[model samples]
Target: MESEMIVIHAENAPMPGISKPGPHQRYRHPVISVEKRRLGALHADEIRVQMIYAGLCGTDVHLMESDPQTGYIRSSAPANIPETGRVIGHEGIGKVLAVGKNVRHLSEGAVVTFESIIVCHYCDVCRKGQFNQCRNAKLLGLEKDGIFGKVVDVPAMLAHDVTPIIQTDQDLQAIACVEPAGVAYVACRNTRVTGGDVVVIFGGGPIGVFAAMLCKTIFGASSVSIVEPVSFRRSFAAQWADHVYDVEAFFANMPECIDVVIEASGDLQNINRIFRNVNANGRIALLARSGTSLVLDAMDHMITNAISIIGSRGHLCGAFNDIISLYKQGRLPLHQVVTHILDGTDGFMRLVGAIDSVLYENCKVLIRFASANGRS
Candidate 1:
């Protein structure tokens, strides 16, 4: 269990002269309250983290506004309001408060970020070396309460230390982005992107921009273009993508054939359009999430063009280490992806706004839970 200090209100009580609220109270110390975990665990391989920053994902937004009647979120636990009914956020970066005795490489006070998908390594799929396809997978924020609160306990294998690569405050802010970058890396790997190949990504969102960057930096693609209707997002994407075009402009000025197409927007229409745009022997990686299904001409478009359609769901565990190494080497421009930073108080509302899709032009929104001094 974790505890939080709360200042008591009383008449004639002296205020503290501390710089931050936690340990430096000059007068009476704040009261400590026990934090409850929805799912109980302190496994030998688990580590407890005191979350300092958490990034808001599109999926977080989906859960916020999902209709109860339709049941868009399918999970064993209540996604909307888990055990504590507190704020829920998945993409997180924090300090290791405690590590179980069996944990080897990690220690207390280490700055780290973790993978959201908790995979059961002993499962049949995991035994096949396909951990991403684990039959009994539970997502952090989806199946249980997430790291929106001040503390979270997660499996040590999912945690990666960011202290070596994160030098400045900006670098620390970008740690939350590493997870999504890994997602894009997996998408590009699924498409079998190679050097000197032309890539077109649909969606100028964070994942799309990250995919574009990964194509040029990691995959060594010859050129990359992004298709998005939002001018703000297009301009932001232009900083990384070789070319940025709106949906109509993408259709008007598209190349005769695209070597690779990555669908990251989850827009049904954009997904269907990939069939006519991909070149012969090209590959399409679908990384989008949508409620509606898209119909495509499989025989005429896929078979005739020899285009391989693949769906990429989650990132491989090693991808995080790879992306962090690249970032440390100054190869990836991850810091440029975060456009908005919010105080922890407004994280839930801002995440809801980000999910609306049309309401906000967000690349990445981060929630600052506590400062370096431990003040909220």
Candidate 2:
């Protein structure tokens, strides 16, 4: 007999007041519904997990607002839209309930979190040890059934057993967020931030905040600053960065002083101006995904100054383990980053409302399952 479980489902629908794609075409919001799904037999290389907590990501919001014409999430490439609505979410932690016969490393009752990108090991990029950029990579929430369900069967190789490092409920919360924080970790690593380097990060979202935290604690940067337009986010960023400034305040006095710039905000409008703030021989890492084309008119200046711009994608496979180690050492103060934790049992609309309202005041919102209610 199959067990029934609740899952969040996402599907595309046409935007109101718009008929066809044009210059001002506004994409419709994804039709979200809460439904019960019946689970089938677990695969040989998979482990069944009962989710405890799941983080709401910007990518989730993007997937919820996919382009009507292409059926793809706007600004993101190589993602397919399933003909039927799909379960949505990737960043989460859970307890293992059962393990496949072939899964030797993990067993029942182990605490685990997953690598969101399911890579095809035979791909050329995977053979080159660039698994994150696998040509045949399938994103968990985007291309397959994801962890939004109460129970999910995950590939054994993709599951990271965090049971050893989890000392407190806070640790579990941080582990749930490891997927996004790992992205920030890769961003900082890709830029090669060293001790004494002065860094400025654009945007004060969770990834931006994580980058700032890693720059200070792990990389030993001399100073880290955050430039964000939202006052609420600025307040949150102030806890991790040396200085937090609104857009105008940042530009007035800090031009040409930064050694590194990490762009975590996908705000293309102000991206061009950030080039003017980097000192000669400086580096910038872009971590955001946007559909719009970036127009950089500062190519001449960039060439003359010897500045480098790097594009960073998802986290490398090792990043998850590295972040888990940092958490074990208690070096990462992740408690400050999670601003809201809502009840997953509250149903689908509450989750949707939280996602909709995250822009104004929330930073790193999480949904807690019933099992996690009294733990910590």
The number of the candidate with the highest TM-score is 2
Tens digit of per-residue lDDT, candidate 1, span 1-376 = 5433111111212235635421111112112122444435667888987777788776655444433553233111223232234335568788887898899999997889878778888999999988777888877765545677666777787888887775677788777788888899999988989997999999888899999999987888998999988888998889888899999998888887789999887776775766687789999887877554677865577787788888887876478888888888889878788888877645544444445542256778777877544566
Clashing pairs in 2: 75-291
Instruction: Write model 2 residue lDDT over 86-142, tens digit each, in one string.
Output: 677788899898999899999898999998888889988899899989998888876
TM-score of each: 0.83, 0.89
The lowest-lDDT stretch of 10 consecutive residues in candidate 1 is 23-32
| Candidate-wise lDDT, in order | 0.72, 0.78
lDDT of 2: 0.78
Screening candidate 1 with a backbone cut-off below 3 angstroms (N, C-alpha, C), the clashing residue pairs are none
Off by over 4 Å in 2: 1-29, 66-78, 345-348, 372-376
